[model samples]
Target: MANSFSGADMSLRTDKAVQRGPALQFTVDDQLVDAFSGESVAAALFAVGRRELRQSPRDSAPRGMFCMMGSCQECLVWVGQRQVPACQVPVAAGLAVQTLSFRRQHLD
Candidate 1:
């Protein structure tokens, strides 16, 4: 899979250049992922090829960012104790994110 983020820009369009903030580091499922400031958690994860953010509560099917605008709850993940949409949350330095896959693995 191609990286969704490049240099300081997170836009997939190569023709249009986007200015982004400083770089930051965050953890997803205990794996470190690099992200630029102003990037959403989902964006960072997609950049690193982490497509599945959670499994369906009922079926255990894989789920990832769909709408990316928070309209769909497909990208929900745990940040600390709260579950929030990954596409809606901004990447922060040292932020630890836990996907539902991790939880399921631990429970099993």
Candidate 2:
């Protein structure tokens, strides 16, 4: 992928860019969290000291976003029943997240 500012100032198109407001909060396991506009799920989690979001079903090893480019499936998290790629998912408001590979009977 190219740099975020590669052609930001040179683009000739008239289309306006989306203006993201202040950090939005999302509830994860009853905990309210903040995520920046250009941040990914894994990045946001790490920023707030959340390391383990899910684990491998067979081994139950910790897993989350790795490589941070959607090339790895380690960052898979449920977004309202649908499995969404966390590394590739942009931070959004009111995002309902669930973990399918969570360790233990229920994650605390």
Candidate 3:
């Protein structure tokens, strides 16, 4: 089998680029969050101590980033009009993300 480097060199606060300068700003579920360059959305959220990214669609069980790679499908989140895996999306200034909790709140 071939090798996959999907998340081989990523960490919440270890990326050199991230440590070199100012962090970018973004919103998670309408709450402000900070993200550094070279950090994925998952890493950014995790940096701020956010573990549960979303919940199961069927049972509402808390879900988070299990496979920093893109195989687990556990980090699903909403960005604008589209649903995306948080682990696969890189962080950028002004980016907006909404987790499953947002949907749950509205359902109540």
Candidate 4:
């Protein structure tokens, strides 16, 4: 599949051409979504309009990408019970991602 960028180009793009690779399939919140190769989990989620990646451990407040460099823990998620920061995880085909909020909701 040919890769295409949607919307205006950013000025900071490198001189090296961006390569669009095949779309990868991953499951988020039990729904299948397509993400491009080399894309981060956070990017995949946001592309699909999934702003709430997890909830606060204290009071269940929704959380998402912030300080995407991994300094902030807002984008926490589970990949087969292993907690990971979404912004730091690369998209993989057939990956099963469960937001902390979903786990709490169904486990109770």
- Stretches of candidate 1 above 4 Å error? 1-16
What's the candidate order when arranged by decreasing lDDT?
1, 3, 4, 2
Kindly list the per-residue Cα lDDT of model 2 for residues 1-89, writing each as its tens digit.
22221123323222377464566766555455666577677776766666677877789788776788878787777776567777777
What's each prediction's TM-score? 0.79, 0.68, 0.75, 0.76
Candidate 2: how many backbone clashes? 0
Q: Each candidate's lDDT (Cα)?
A: 0.79, 0.64, 0.75, 0.74
TM-score of 1: 0.79
Per-residue lDDT of model 4, residues 11-98, tens digit only: 2223387685677777776777667788888887776666788767689788899887787988988888788999998889889888
Model 4: residue 57 alpha-carbon error in angstroms: 3.7
> In model 4, which range of ten residues has the least summed lDDT?
3-12
Model 1 C-alpha lDDT per residue in residues 33-56, reported as the tens digit of each score: 778789899987776666788778
User: If both were scored by TM-score, which would come out higher, candidate 3 or candidate 4?
Assistant: 4
Arrange candidates, best TM-score first.
Answer: 1, 4, 3, 2
Summed over model 1, clashes come to 0
- Write down the lDDT that model 2 would get: 0.64
